[model samples]
Target: MESGTSSPQPPQSDLLDVFPQKGLEPGDIVVLVLYFLFVLAVGLWSTVKTKRDTVKGYFLAGGDMVWWPGLFSVLMLAWIFLPIYIAGQVDMYAGAIFIQQSLHLDLYLAIVGLLAITAVYTVAGGLAAVIYTDALQTLIMLIGALTLMGYSFAAVGGMEGLKEKYFLALASNRSENSSCGLPREDAFHIFRDPLTSDLPWPGVLFGMSIPSLWYWCTDQVIVQRTLAAKNLSHAKGGALMAAYLKVLPLFIMVFPGMVSRILFPDQVACADPEICRKICSNPSGCSDIAYPKLVLELLPTGLRGLMMAVMVAALMSSLTSIFNSASTIFTMDLWNHLRPRASEKELMIVGRVFVLLLVLVSILWIPVIQASQGGQLFIYIQSISSYLQPPVAVVFIMGCFWKRTNEKGAFWGLISGLLLGLVRLVLDFIYVEPRCDQPDERPVLVKSIHYLYFSMILSTVTLITVSTVSWFTEPPSKEMVSHLTWFTRHDPVVQKEQAPPAAPLSLALSQNGMPEASSSSRVQFEMVQENMSKTHSCDMTPKQSKVVKAILWLCGIQDKGKEELPARPEPVIVSLEENPLVKTLLDVNLIFCVSCAIFIWGYFA
Candidate 1:
């Protein structure tokens, strides 16, 4: 960040604590620094390999963007938490990793350093660097997780042994207090009490699914990876990879968390606020600390260092993905809108600079995020998304499928839904949840109604308002909605209408439907077009110095030599594979993924 502030400490007031307190040893520090260096090297290498001067190269690598399944987003979570919380539509986990942070380390060091490394690689190599580094990060995460998983299974015996002991622990906990605000009797079950449980069956299966869909399917951060892939086969394979990886988290994180509560019930399942404060300094039980604690207590010193690197890897992977994607949205979508005539080089520079500003904003938000929901990091994120994201999900779904959704209806619907969501968000912070034993002072809707349930209500309200307003207003043109909605995605007629071949720049400069142009307007238009050509063209090589050439080489900016870039025509791509063998494999993998999902739900139902 811009200022040297105190690093965030592990939750002292309310998060759960388990590991024997320790500082970063010399080995850990060395390993972490080395890992950071490696990531930086990879980014620089990628920058050399991939084009980066254009928006597409920087944001999407040197390939086409596509429509990837939401499952694709959460693929890395099992390795790092199986994108389960992410698949489950959890928010940024930079804060989650800090729940059981190391002793004597500044929170800023972890958060800021992570963001800075990611930004360097992103700004240097663009999306190519991020993807390759993510691959390495995913590998490290799985190795670290499996190491902890092995230790946990060994510590508790096998699955059957753990289950037997888990039941015994739950029974004893119940004897102390049936309603002890500790781990629930149905802790292992996915379908819990509709009103009392943290994740009600109805909410998990239905309400939470809304925001989850938006996160996986529509969110820019996750989709950016897919868009960088070479073709439809590669994208589908990548999503299948996610599904395959997802099957491991319940084993990697969830079961390990259960084992934590069973083994260290006093810490993970603390019932009294005083006892909890003594344990993790947070009155909330410390399930979030389970995985980290397992690593610290079980792994040897070198392995501990490796796991630390893995945790850092996970943190960096996520932040980089988010920062890069956010910059893309800001530079292309928002910036381009504001300055429609701005040059491509200007867009690239602004995008990189925007990442630094985002880093500062995140650093500032850390304190506020830490205080939210009393230190339940993942849940706080999920609930906020519950309040704000369902309406966006509804709008996206309708805009694509229902051809009548106009800009006015979409814009107004967002404003209306956002206002209501914000009211709930503000009230949540102001009238905070009371201590476990104390009476809740908040409104019934705030206190009693689950945020997931609120999401459904908000979604219905948004959809109705949007639909009604659209019905009374002008409809979106067929061309406007063409190839966007599900029904129209495969229509060859609409697809053909979407993209036209490029014409000579001179012809395009004066080819607007209004043929009659004033002499002054024509000259001004040519001047603007010629200026754009100069900014993008490499014809200035004879006048350029060594420093500028070096900067261009390092950033992977390929000069256009003698050829000017044609104004691109975007084509609607069919994501399904055409190759018989690959298509068959994809179909089978998809079926297997769905089967696994069904099996998990049924086993826990």
Candidate 2:
């Protein structure tokens, strides 16, 4: 890699011409190929080994996964919600795309291939495959990320050197007397000036917590991972371990990003719109390319491919969790609402199809992601989330904690808050940020107020709306609040009389409008229901062709045409009990974890 030159250059010289372009070597290609094959192997193994014949098996991994894998799986998906872990996973997908563009790889090919490979296992094996593959990805990501972090720190001569050099990384042609293309004055601080800094102290303390609460507590993606745990103990263990893992990204991603800016300030910190456009095809700024630029220019051939694999792992981990959760939400919530009598098999098919459709739609949104928030992907994500998520978060929080929060209040509050946020969102799109050093032309609400502050305002308004509506509306039924609110979670479930199990459609049709069950008919129905209760190794019809059977096996589906509906079992009591010793250990660890987190924030502040 060439050192940064301070020598003067022609004003019109293309940035592309200024720096020599590099592509993946043969060894890099080999490593990347091996990584892909390994991922597919893991996916295939999970698909065959894991049970996925029922909704619980497919969507929640049968609630059987142990703590260790669940820990890594949660780390892969949930890291983005926490402030300290925010920069790590966001960099993965965005960094991967930037790396492809940097290497002059075919962008469309890369996107399609990545999404297709992810969709294959995700659609076929469901959440079990996602969790299994995520555990593997977590390992690869740690290795590759730590490897780069080591190389990065060495290149920068350690933390002391980084602090000295990062501030010096400024674009040569940056306009005098302007902050454009310069490192932030509070770059090293967590708590910054409330009014002027990119991340304000008050907003970080108050506003950021709203979305974080929503993500950790209510978001389907994060909750689904915990739902796969075997017991409360395993769930606690996984969550605690994931919390510990959060400390790694500060070293792995944040420091390396700073190192990239220091090492290649000319490219990563380019201020000239024309120069950035020529380099990354985005004139906003090339800061988003920091990590990718580091991987390409700083690493050896094989290691370069390993980091590529890491990026791929990160991308797949994030995407699979999202795809699985979205599928679950759509199938169980929307589809079930529309078709109450839809069979489990039909739900399964619908969920898988939804994933496929999501992939296709996601591909179409790539351009918008690439261009948003001055080409900084993480900022775009947070800003958009602020615009939409705070309201939903408020509703969830209120519904859980406040017994008085009726359905009408929650609904109207959410609608009102979302409308306000949506207006801000539309205005933001219509009046995009101007290029650095250009005039500020956006509205006062858009330009003067920060997104995080806007989130705080949104949340307050939502709380007000919910409270006002609930005060005037009729109180909710006791049954509705029982065992549902946080205060009532420990209350006993109000059991209702068990309804007789419905007969399978095939059996019902065969009976031919028998209005009353004679003793003989009841006996036959009981026998059929008993038979349906047990699991069978193979449920497909012998008459089906070998080809069709093979496809069904691959998809983890039974031949529903010949299958009998299983009798619904009586609900069992869920024991929240844990081994006293394990509980003590976890409780101790939680205190330690929280302490460490607080120390880091204060030290950084």
Largest TM-score belongs to which candidate?
Answer: 2
Which residue pairs show collisions in model 2? Answer: none
Query: What is candidate 2's CA lDDT for residue 30?
Result: 92
Which candidate gets the maximum lDDT versus the true structure?
A: 2
Could you tell me which 10 consecutive residues in candidate 2 have the lowest summed lDDT?
75-84
Off by over 4 Å in 1: 1-19, 64-100, 167-181, 272-275, 278-281, 493-577
Model 1: how far residue 512 lies from native, Å: 24
Residue 572 alpha-carbon offset, candidate 2, angstroms? 3.4
The segments of candidate 2 whose C-alpha lies over 4 angstroms from its true place after superposition are: 1-20, 72-96, 503-543, 560-567
Tell me each candidate's TM-score: 0.82, 0.89
Model 1 lDDT-worst window of ten: 76-85
lDDT of each: 0.68, 0.77
Give the Å error, residue 117, model 1: 1.7
